[model samples]
Target: MEDLLGSYIIFLILLFVETKGIPPVTLAIIILNMFIFLSPALGVGEVCLSVSTTLYGCEWQRLALAPLHHIDLDHLGFNMASLVWKGSRLERRIGSARFTFSICSFGLLTGLTYLLIKATLSFLLSDRFNLDCAVGFSGILFALKVINNGHSCDGNIPGPFHIKKRDACWAELVLIHLLSPRSSFVGHLAGILVGLAYVMGPLRMMINWITGKETSSVRFAECCQLSRNGHPDRDSDGDCQSTCLPRHRRQRRRC
Candidate 1:
């Protein structure tokens, strides 16, 4: 990951200097990436290649693990710096739990998208490099850029190049591929597509619906627990019909 992606790394490092409120889930992911990278037991062969049809068999679990492993300290640093930058914005805006769900879901989708892209390339054009393996958080970082930009498209993605928020992810993909000829081009492309898919609609709705349901379940469970203790959901207006969270502000601002 060099050139445009590398420039982003520098920009993100400078951008990440302000780490005021790095959320819990984001912190866990940064820690996990570091642990995975530093541990000799989890080397590249063990945690690499989310999917490579011509090489390793599809284990499925690797899809989640690959994003947590990086090739080197610089790679890890760039991604973690980015995680801190983007994760702070996203987790604060959407809350940690929902952010966690979004990461896992979009991460897997990005891996699968990589698989589909490789398969299509190999089948349609017989691209030999489709069998290669790639490992890093860059793919998911691209997706986070999508969500991040969608939430606040007030300006351009700052770096050496001036790119509007709406087109920044794609612009980075092409530029990185062009400038860093050895980079994981298809993998990066897959990430941008996954990001577009998310911002365009389906993924966002699914995450929101799932998290909302989980929150409601917890609220109900808390209400039941209180009832067992000779108390129940006591609303401000004396009507518990609104549930335990008072029906309005129990969740984060995203609520």
Candidate 2:
């Protein structure tokens, strides 16, 4: 309960600094999660992520929904805090449409990764790992963290452990699992693996192909120009070239 309250405080602080209020993609996700958490009618537990249940019982919808479900208030709180940071930043850095597709794909892939690893371990170890379920948005957060840091310098992250900014999220995943026995160690590890796969794998290409969307490189460049020129207001028509300098001049300035 205390942790949940602290998360709310942190969330409010994040809202203050965020250039844009909650991006639509992130807002929709938060609302969905809140509804699931507050309404006993939702029954997230019945569909939570469990390897045995997923494979044997064939509850495939759990793969998509489990990441939205939290184990408890603290679990939900911590994940939401991370979500506000990573979601807002990444969604802004890339367009909101891309950000939504990326997270949805990551969540699905993360669940698949966990299921595969659990099945392998169960087959080889013969009763070592538990068939119990896992649930949280932490996996998607880790993937977003990887994507965010992959694109920019994340700066010196403050911590006693002193991990590099790019590597801090991975370190935090390990630390969180180690500190809390009840936390899903395998689930978090699966998230990291899935994150790596999403960044390095052809999943991105597949996304582009399916969505028929071009890379955000040009859009991002235009947005930077708009901000630099003190015209941060985005045109509702979606054309970023509004009130912007010519391409050659912008290139020359860069050179």
Candidate 3:
């Protein structure tokens, strides 16, 4: 997790450099140092400790204020750098601001959901077992994979041996079979659901709302008919009149 955080920090720095006049090559070097070298040196234990202390310890405020400064490089390691790199590339293609927001939101939501479920299970089975100390990028990674593969509805990539239609469904089934007995799978499932909801719900709404600024969902022919009858085409014209006005004006007298 610390490694992931380090990568995020490096990406942010690269963004800053791009905004300025700094060379992109320099940013690449920084990325290599932070992700490839520093991360493995730090390992997983330090990363978990950092998260626990920053989010729940007495010095939470200070740690939260400057988490990058406090990350322990000596206790972090990479698990699947290649997969993360691919996911990061996909995220860049999706647009950095949107990707960043979605990733962070999914991570937080998945973590909270896992914590709640574990807590509930522990209560229900009192003294039988204890659930504590969970950490991994599996959830966020799964979420990114889902988003990159074009959401749950799009299904999986079809190949000679791949399943068709409900591709995502099959991939998920395989994932469950592979990871079922592990605690991390719970978080992974939560993240997948969060990713699907985000893409199909809020993110879809936001993108449509933004792009539909000068148009309505109503068909153009319907708009013309309503407008010609002297009644406001409230569904379309009212919102899109400006977009259509120049063409309309060019065909008629201005008087």
Candidate 4:
């Protein structure tokens, strides 16, 4: 019990410090999730993502707020840790505007995915559908994890069984599901689908429109490289125009 308490204490301290230099949207998301989880007395749980309530009763707002609530300390801590690790890097790579847009799009879709599945199951199995009252930011974490792994070049992710970088997201999905019983499997699976949709489907086009940045192919590389050189701003044409660039070389070459 003492160890558990200590873990929570440490998590709180780390969360406080982790916001430093984090992309604005990412930091705000972490703060919002933490605040809502710690303030359950405010009746945040009623807005939790519920398939039955959302679909049958038409409480659509729950889909937006549900990911911000958590079942317990462990669930919250695990999801937050993953968010900090993957979200911070992805936000830096894609820029805050695109990152925020992606999070909103992905979060809603994940809830909708769960809703679709539950509705189908209900129809197929009448009285036997288990309406899992899912909550927490795991779905977004999973979505961000998929995006991060796709853009990362840090080689393989180290673990009990070493896995290649490209395959790490799937490995994590499987492993975390096996370890975290409280986590919603369908929600995380939906997050994966959303990530893939963004990468391969029309969602990518929407993100590009939202941020005015090309998110498809070369933009990830350009964003990471330019940010590394301390140039977060891009030109109207979506090319790096950092003040750090030489006057003659600003448009033609890297800083």
Q: What is the C-alpha lDDT of each candidate?
A: 0.68, 0.70, 0.44, 0.69
- lDDT tens string, model 4, 174-253? 87879876567778888887887776647778777767865333433433344556555555423344342343234445
TM match of model 4 to true structure: 0.74
lDDT of 1 at 162: 78
What does candidate 3's lDDT look like per residue over 29-91, in tens digits?
235545544445443334331223433453333211221222233222232342344344444
Model 1 per-residue lDDT tens digits across residues 1-255: 356555754655565565654678987887677666656566677766633532347577778777887877777787788788778867776677877888898888888888777777777886664666788899988888776666552345557777776787788788877886767887788888888787676776677688773343222223322455666544432223334445335543322
Q: Could you give the C-alpha RMSD of every candidate to the true structure, in order shown? A: 11.3, 6.5, 12.0, 6.7
Q: Once superposed on the true structure, which residue ranges of model 1 sit more than 4 Å away at CA?
A: 1-17, 50-56, 157-162, 213-255
Ordered by TM-score, highest first, the candidates read 2, 4, 1, 3
Q: Which stretches of candidate 3 lie above 4 Å from their native place?
A: 1-79, 82-86, 126-130, 151-183, 203-255
Instruction: Give the least accurate 10-residue stretch of model 4, judged by summed lDDT.
Output: 215-224
Q: Count the backbone clashes (under 3 Å) in each candidate.
A: 0, 0, 8, 0
lDDT top scorer: 2
Model 2 — which ten-residue stretch has the worst lDDT? 217-226
Question: What ordering of candidates by lDDT runs from best to worst?
Answer: 2, 4, 1, 3
Error of 1 at 131 (Å): 1.4
Name model 2 segments beyond 4 Å from true: 1-20, 42-44, 128-130, 154-156, 159-162, 217-255
| Residue 156 displacement (Å), model 2 | 4.5
Q: Clashing residue pairs in candidate 1, if any?
A: none
